[model samples]
Target: MSGENETVTYRVEDHVAVITLNRPEQRNALNFDAYDRLERAFRQAVRDPDARCVIVTGADPAFCSGDDVREIMAGPKPAIPPPPTVRHAPTPAAMAALECDKPVIAAVNGAAVGWGMELALYADIRIASEKAKFAELFIKRGLTCDVGGFYRLPAIVGPAKAAELLFTGDVIDADEALRIGLVREVAPHAELMDRARALAARIACNPPLALRYMKEGLRRAAYGDPRELGGWAIETIRTLMKTEDHREGVASFLEKRAPVFTGR
Candidate 1:
């Protein structure tokens, strides 16, 4: 899928699919072309059976600089704004990773600002390098967080922390990211990709069906009232009880052996 999409390069390694943002010359900015191309790349991952998870990161010093401002301002600003919503969705390619039953992890290799941060937000998990820096950046530019950042950040870091970040548009490092629960872990700059792949591999080894339900359960909990979450949790557990992996897991515990799961 490398040459198939000009703005994004899709690759699979050990069942961990990755969509690398490749426009370093432009700081991997979310140009319209990038958006359109990424939509395709993500859908490709959705159709890949061998892939149970994915990682998205940039090729160089910046994960993304957000939408290409030069491109957007290249034309007149729309008299009417898009309103408060996820800017990159409705395109199946961009929404694919978010809606995918499989997990998606973001490896924030470097600076992530503006919509770039939102791209990471859409992932199920986040891992970043110490060198990684993040900021909402919308307010700084006389705009609001029109992308998914406003919605996703609070869910990851809680409402207060998310408000602080958005209100100040302050840049934060990896340590702060970990403190706020925005990222699962942080690694040295040189080890960022290795760590991200390792985490993805771990999630990939879990039973795919159970993992899918687990992800759904979490998303459901995040988006709704407590009663809905209670019902979903019960149903998910019931479904998992019927899987071969669950039987193996219990037996392995009883037999004092490591469970060998084939994502059944």
Candidate 2:
């Protein structure tokens, strides 16, 4: 099932819905259209009776580099102001992968930065290539973490490590990610997808109903109540979006220079 846009592609093989991020030229950095398409693809996979598991990967050389800086910052500003409802409600795309009842496995082939790393965190299991790199780069954009990163990262890698990553926005190699339990296994670049599919197939073999129930149970155990934290995160992100530091961050990024944050 291909997406409305070619930016994302979804196909089923051996009961696994393999969703590929297709924009390798931008390192699969998602623009608004790609984000919407990705969310739809995940929702489709969840609803597809034939797909018992879902595997997300990118077209070689990169998994996802997070948002397209140019698209977000360099694009022309809107002439009309956004309505109040738009400002208050967070986008559902950020949590679409997590909302899926079937298991999600991220095959991190290469760089997974910012929301890219956050996307992997949403997965029930993650498998990375030896060449894979991960980062929580929201700070670099003068933005707070979105896409459920604030809620999921701490649980997967522990609070201290998660804080360090989020605060510094440092990139970590696959070995470091594996050591910290961010990924279950790391394979050679060529075998990354193969390993992911093997695991997906194993899970797909299980009874679909049982898998769904197990996923729900685990979700409840890990996240007792997501509402309060999720609300705070969305509001904080909205506040940060209007800051001068964020504009500077985006400008510096496009100009290939360092950002001078004023803490505004």
TM-score of each: 0.76, 0.93
Q: Residues 197-238, candidate 2, lDDT per residue (tens digit)? A: 999999999999999999999999996545566666677776
Tell me the whole-model lDDT of each prediction, alpha carbons only.
0.73, 0.85
Cα lDDT of model 1 by residue, 1-264, tens digit: 687447888899888899988888888887767776777778888788888888999988889877776564233542123325433233233356567668888899988987788788878888998888888976554445643554467877888988999888899988988988988888888999999898899999988778879988987787433233333433443455456675565456446786676556
- Clash counts per candidate, in order, are 1, 0
Please identify model 1 stretches exceeding 4 Å from their true place. Answer: 76-94, 224-264
Assess candidate 1 and give its lDDT: 0.73
Candidate 2 scores a C-alpha RMSD against the true structure in Å of: 2.5
lDDT of 1 at 6: 70
TM-score of 1: 0.76
Query: Using alpha carbons, what is the TM-score of model 2?
Result: 0.93
